[model samples]
Target: MGIRVGTRDDAEAIAEVHIASWRVGYAHVLPESVLYADDFEPRRRAIWSEWRFAPTQRVAVSVDDTDRVVGFAAYGPERERARGTTGRGELYAFYFHPDVWGNGAAAGLIDHVGERLRAEGFDEAVLWVLDDNPRARAFYERHGWHPTGIAADFDVHCELSVPEVEYHSPLTVEGRP
Candidate 1:
C-alpha cells in the first residue's frame, strides 16, 4: 500500500471510503437514516471534490497494491478558534474502508498526514472523535494524541446529535525554511 496527495479524480473513491467507514464506525452512534441515505455518496463526493482542491487544505489518500483507494485523511489550518492558546492545525477528516480497519491502513494514513502538517509548518494538530467511539479514541491515543478535556455536541445531517471530544498531538518541528 502507498499514500499519495489526493487529486480531483480521487474524490469519488475518497467519498466511497468515507461513507463505508462511517457506516460501520458510526453505526451505533449515528442515525441510520443519515448513513443509509440514497444521496450520501454523491453529496460527499461533491464536497470532497471541492475540498480536495482548496488552497489551505491538504488531502492524502492511501491505496492498496492494486491502486484502489482504501483510506484518506484531510488536514489544514484550524477552523475553530482555540480558547486558551493560538489555534493549531486540524485533522478535519480521516477514514478508511471497514475491511482495512485492523490492517494498519489508518495508522499509515495518520502518519502521512502528520508529515504533511509538519512540513506545512504546523507545530501541533487537533482532531475530533465521537466520545462514544472508544475504539477510535484509543486509536488516536495510541498515535500520540490526547484529549484536551473539550467536548461538544455534533449534529449530523441535521438529524443525529452526538457528543465529541478533541484530541491533540505535537508534530515534529523541523527548522523553518
Candidate 2:
C-alpha cells in the first residue's frame, strides 16, 4: 500500500471508508438507526467534499497497490478551545475500510498525520475516540497515546449520544510517537 496526501478526487473514497468503518466499528456502540440510515452515503459524501477543500485541515489517504483509497486521516488546529491547551493539533478523523482493519494502513496514515502536524508547529496532538471502543483505545495506547481523563458526549448523526475520551501525545522534533 502507498500513503499520499489527499486530493479532491479522494473525497468519495474517503467518505466510503468512513461509513464502512463506522458501520463495522460502531455496530454495537451506536444506535441502529444512526448506523443504518439510508441517506448516510450522500450525507457523508457531502461532508467529505467540504472537508476536502477546507483550508485549515490536512488530509491524507492510504491506497492499495491498485491506487484505491483504503483509509484516510484528517487533522488540523484544535477546534475545541475549551481544552485549555495552546499550540495543539487535533486529529479530526481517522478511518479505514473494514476490510483493512488488521493491516498497517491505519498506522501509516496516523504517522503521516503526526508528521504533518509536527511540521505545522504543533507541540502536541489530541484525538477523541468512543470510550467503549476498546479496540481503538488499545490501538492508540500502543502508539503511546494516553487518555487525559476528559470525557464528553459524542452525537452520532444527532441520533445517538455516546461517551468519548480524549487521547494525547506530545510531538517531538522527530515526530516519533
Candidate 3:
C-alpha cells in the first residue's frame, strides 16, 4: 500500500472506505439503522466532496496496489480547544476498509499524519474513540495514544448518542510510535 495526500478526485473512494469501515468496525457499537442508513453513502460522498485542506488542516489516504483508497485519516487544529494549549492538533477521523485491517495500511496513514502534524508545529494530538469500540481504542493505544479521562456523549442524530473517550499523544518525538 502507498500513502498520499488526498485530492478532490478521491472523494468517492474515500467515501467508500469510510462507509465500509463504519459498517464493519462499528457494527456492534452503533445501531444497524445508523450504520446501514440508505443515505449514508450519498451523504459521505457529498461531505468528502466539500473537503478542503489548509495550512493546519489536511487529509492523507492509503491506497492499494490498484491505487484505490482503502483507508484515510483527517486531521487539523484541535476543534475543542483547551485552555493553555495552542500546540495541540486533533485527529478528526480515521477509517479503513475492513478487508485491510491487520495489513498495516492504517499504521502507515497514522505515521504520515503524525509526521505532518509535528512538522506543522503541533506538540500533541488528540482523537476520540467510541467508548465501547475496544478494537479501535486498542489500535490507538498500540500507536502510543493514551486516554485523557475525558468523556463525552457524541450525538449523531435526534436523540441518538454514543459515549466517546479522548486519547492523546505527544508529537514532539520524531519517529515515535
Candidate 4:
C-alpha cells in the first residue's frame, strides 16, 4: 500500500469511507439512519465541502498498488484543551476505514502526520475519542497516548450529543518507543 495527499477528485471515495466508518465504528452509539440516511447527495456534498477545505489539516489517504484509496486520515495543528497545551501545537484528527483496520494503515497515518507536525516544530499531539469506543481507546493507549480524564461535549448529527475522552502524547510518543 502507498499513501498520498487527498485532492478534490477523492471526495466521493472519502465520503464512502466516512460513511462506512461511521456505520462500523459507531454501530451501537449512533442511529443507523444517521449514516445510512436517504440523503446521500447532501451528505456527500457536505463532506466534500468540509473535508476539502478544513484548515490546518491535511488528508492523507492510503491506496493499493492499483491506486485505490482504501483508508485516509486528516491531521494538523490545533489547540489542545486536553493536553494542558495552551500554546503547544497539536494534531486534531486521525481515522482509517474499517477495511484496513489491522493492516498497519493506522500506524502509517500517525507516521504521516508526525512527519508533518514535526517538520512544523510541533513536538506533541492530542485527540479526543468517545470514552465508550474501547476499540479506538485501546488503540490509542497502545500507541502511547495517556488519558487526561478530560471529557468534553461532542455533537453528532446535530441532534445527538455525547462526551469525549481526551488523550495526549508528547514528542517521543510517551510510552511507546
lDDT of each: 0.83, 0.85, 0.83, 0.71
Residues 111-177, candidate 3, lDDT per residue (tens digit)?
8888988887788889888999988999999989999998889876557899998899998576443
| Candidate 2 lDDT, 8-102, residue by residue in tens | 98998999998899899999887778877887777889989885559998888999999999998888988764366666899989889989988
lDDT, residue 83, model 3: 38
Maximum-TM-score candidate:
2
How accurate locally is residue 119 in candidate 4, as Cα lDDT from 0 to 100? Answer: 67
lDDT, candidate 1, 118-148, per-residue tens: 8777889888889999898889998889998
Quote the positional error of residue 63 for candidate 3 in Å: 0.7
- Residues 1-177 of candidate 4: C-alpha lDDT, one tens digit per residue: 888988878877777777777788988887776767777447756876675547666777888788877777666665656444554445455556788889887776666666666666677767788877988888878877788778887877657787888777775643221
1 against 2, candidate with superior lDDT: 2
Backbone clashes under 3 angstroms, per model? 0, 0, 0, 0
Model 3, position 165, has a per-residue lDDT of: 89
Per-model TM values vs. the true structure: 0.91, 0.94, 0.92, 0.84
Off by over 4 Å in 1: 81-87, 173-177
Candidate 4 Cα outliers beyond 4 Å, as residue runs: 79-86, 173-177
lDDT preference between candidates 1 and 4, better one: 1
Instruction: List the candidates ranked by lDDT, beginning with the highest.
Output: 2, 3, 1, 4
